[model samples]
Target chain A: MLRALSVIVICGTAAMASSQSNPPNETRSSPATVVPQQQTPTKSTAIIGLDGVKEKTAGTLNVKDGKLCFVHSRNKSQISAAAIADVVTGEDSQRVIRGTLGTLSMFAPYESGRAISMLRSKIDILTIQYRDDDGGLHGVIFTMPVGAAEPIKQELITQGAHTTIQTAAVAARGKQ
Target chain B: MTNFFRITMCSCLFAMLSLAGPHLHAQRKDTEKIKASALKVEMIQSDQIAVPAAFQVAVYENLIQQLGKKASFLHVYRDGDRDAASIPNLVVLHTTVSRFKEGSEEMRQVTTVAGATSITIHCRFTSADGKLLLEKDVNGKVRFFGDNRKATYDFAKRASAVVSDKFSANGQS
Candidate 1:
């Protein structure tokens, strides 16, 4: 009886050991299984173009203060807000500025910093308007990086926009 | 012997799995970080104004000429009247200060004076309406032998060149 009991004890121990090594055939949850759950989702905002503003394939979209903001990813350095001066919505969305030649050249000093300084340029606040795909309109305030304002303005003119180059003092406080 | 072998195999498998977890997690985190740093700028509009007075106008016009077709000038009073008027891409404020003296000493003193005078212009740029695009204070020493127009013209020309270079570099029209 003592020998028989010893064999039974050894057999039971072997079975338990085998079970522990292979785990259970049923789904055995591990502490490691919860690790994936620990990862949190990261959210980012993007700006998308709508309606009159032709949407570029590579860009981002975001809504700020109730206005839709569209940013083209190709020129990652350029950022425009929904509000710009003289935004016209029709078949195409356009921003218009009316001033004399002197005003146009006034941007020189701001541009100076661009050439000599590493700091990003700051543009004054202008009005911007958004036209939705379904013909809805939204307006927002916007600022551009310095130096970029002129090129965009020029492009608008070249596109047959009636750009009026005007003269005025430098931007005044609270004017932008 | 069977029990001992089973125990050894389980321990080896756990150890390998544990080692791989951190590397996989780290790789994912790195990818998320890269997507956060990109930014872009979009332009809206610009307005520029010229300094009044004939000497200033002469100086300003000479400067505008250097800007080529990139910029133009207008009288300040008519800036707001939008009767089929074109909007300026930028606005420039020009002022001329004359100090009669000889050589660099005169220029140095004028620089200090000009610097003080520029505070108002700087403030305007900071303001919402002025939207001061650029400001350049040019000091001309009205020499007995030198033409003030020429001196002012030279200063405006240099400033315009600097501004134009910046505009082009920024990808402005």
Candidate 2:
């Protein structure tokens, strides 16, 4: 009778221990490390295309330890360089003055609004498509100075990112 | 008597055939409609308007997400996805921003009537062979609350609503 009681207690303890050992997967499946976006000290605007981080953040982006990281304020987000499937770059232009000033300028009298619209500055856009741990595809787009995105693309390619279009070819396509 | 019975059987068979013919035709039409329900969202184009890169990207991404949630396309394909080419009755969506006004969040919060962000996109849905399906000019606006990017979300929702109202998805209207 004592042996039977001992066996029952032992089985219950083992079952409880096994159940506790398998924790629930409540955490999201994303890259573990974070990376910065700006290569230089000046931070650029980065719009993260991931599920959680979907806002336009001002940050410095860089490739550190084979990961593309974006450091904004106190937060950091990264994706593995090897996981990037495609890199596409585009060139566009925006008004010289932006935000509230730009929008308000549209209300200027007569042809002033039209003339202010003509004062445009060229910009570069970089888009990166990468996969997460679960093999889910994600994309990110960031805009920088006219000549900034090309070097970043080169750095990403050197660090194992993939791209189908050459830098010059992309520039030409954007022109078209 | 045998001849009369044969005649009667022939009449009954013809009656059944006539009754079932319209039903079969309707079913075939439904099948064709479902086949054309597959949709592929192309990247938003801003060649005409000087839309910010962020707004362009936001529109494209939000449209894809909203279509999946609101519309019932058999399969939704992203831009440049290779698998979309082989789809038999794929519909491609092309969006061009006609007008965009970037508003200030602080201004909107301070003076709700003053700062209003608005976007107007010309959405064109076409077949795989470049045949036009449906085209409409949709407008989205954020008058009071939320960021300027919320206009993109509004535009996506309205576009998906248009698609859902027009196209039959998964054999249901």
Candidate 3:
């Protein structure tokens, strides 16, 4: 009886040890799962610069062949670097859309009729500010919508005549 | 004899468990990594040198509609000649934000994420002689949706509204 009991104990110990050691096939499959994840690229390469701006893990910024490039989080489309002509910075800084003066005039008038009359008479500079997706800003030059170029020029000249383009950061700080 | 057999079996089982444990952990880590990678933003643009006029018109129209009353005025000039004009209280600038249809596959394949996502234009408004005026970067994110053109438009619209408010207040100065 003593010998039989001893054998039974040994068998139980061996069974417990086996059960604890093997774990599950799923567990063994972890390495395979990990390898692929490690290989996947997370973000696109894009560069962005601005004040009070923090880098999010969504996309990336980079310069390719002297052109700035940014990849979106989802579809990963390829765009020409030249599409971005320039980057403007400041509080109210904006990206100027490349379009005709007529199109831009449609959205924002150069000034009141009086201002227009002056613009038509002489060269009147109209400044338009815009922003891009990367939180950068830009400005563009155009004529006043109204016909008065001279008076508008005079007014601008009196008002320092030069458009004070402020970076979005500076504009935001109310410095411009 | 039985004792020896039991000890050997226990050791082998323990070794197997140890190996499997790390593999499972590593798998979980890998999955987490992939999920993290998929959550980033990218920038992209068109390859064509000259964008079509129709496309440009559409973009301009879309921008005007979005700006509504904020656009003080809008004017389109073809090759430095005035083509169209409008008076809006505000203006907004935007950049194309796009996402890859196949996630980051393009980036992985070409290793050249080229215009996958980015800010292409630096919009600025200045005096005729290039005097600094007002400017901002039209930056945004791309999501899993239709073409990114709409996304860009939407961004422009929202940004324009914000800029209009600021301009109106500052114009008093």
Candidate 4:
């Protein structure tokens, strides 16, 4: 359903971009495709959040009856099509270290503090780029269970998306 | 279908569609935007704290990350960018860590199933004209998992919640 809106937006923005002399500065940071005038709610258990931050709650990202909804904590955001310039998604890993250290301490692999420092990692991250009604470019990212997010991710990409994978940070962690 | 039934059905559908929109009734929404709050968030600064550089870096990066997550601003820049501040109608943010607790994760694992780590941030939102729009002490705490930097994430959310409430003319918070 979100992808449906993206297609509409892309068609609209393409038309507008041709007639206009200068595109709004906001759309320049990332790919800004013209998007739907409305959105509806979607269903599925995936972590969702806004801009470059993903909240803890896991749910679907969709537009329900014209309202942009990310279920789980039931966060509903209102952004008009005119407010948005594009929608893009990508993978992000914001690592954390609490769990890895607690267990690693038992084995005494190395120094406890160093082990903890090396282990921190982000489980999942879903990044999005958008423009608001005022044409201010913005982004929101989410993280979800890798197993379950395939469908949701594919749908958004097929609808019109630019995808990038974060470089593996494990090497850096190992070096540390 | 009977003519009366068909007509009645069409009218009902039309009523539902019209009811769904204010524009359909010719009621124009108040689109007037408050210019003062329509700011491009440029620089975010925080007072130096006597904490681990790693923790401070986490907090700083998280705050910038959270602010960038909002799809409202035309642009959001990091601290080192000197040129962003020169833009018109720029909004600058200042934060200070008034209270901090470097919780021991080892103590947490040994003591109980959950541990407490937290940080309190006093955030100030100011415009180019030197007007203070929001000043709030936001708290971030992580109990079971993650590290003290989790406190930074919580603080970022809490601070953004406060700032967005007052900053967006559309009430984006």
Q: What is the C-alpha RMSD of each candidate to the true structure, in Å?
A: 36.8, 20.8, 33.1, 24.7
Number of the top TM-score candidate: 2
lDDT of 3 by residue, A64-117 (tens): 342322345443322233333322211111112222642343333222211111
CA lDDT of every candidate: 0.32, 0.70, 0.33, 0.49
Candidate 1 vs 2: which has more DockQ: 2
TM-score of 4: 0.39
> A1-176 in candidate 1: lDDT tens per residue?
65565565445544543443342224333222221111121111121223233312334433333233345534332223222223321110111221253234324332321111111112222223333333322333333322223333323323333222311211221166
Rank by lDDT (best first): 2, 4, 3, 1
Report the lDDT of model 1 for residue A142: 30
In candidate 2, stretches whose alpha carbon ends up further than 4 angstroms from where it belongs are: A1-48, A51-62, A65-176, B1-35, B170-172
Candidate 3 chain A worst ten-residue window by lDDT: A114-123
Tens digit of per-residue lDDT, candidate 1, span B1-173 = 99999999999999988998899888755434111111111111212433322233334334434454332222221112232133333333333342322232112222323311110111011111345444444343333222233454455455554444334322423
Model 3 bad stretches (over 4 Å): A1-176, B1-58, B72-120
- Superposed model 1: Cα runs more than 4 Å off: A1-176, B1-54, B69-128, B140-146, B169-173
What's the C-alpha lDDT at position A127 in model 4? 44
Better of 1 and 3 by TM-score: 3
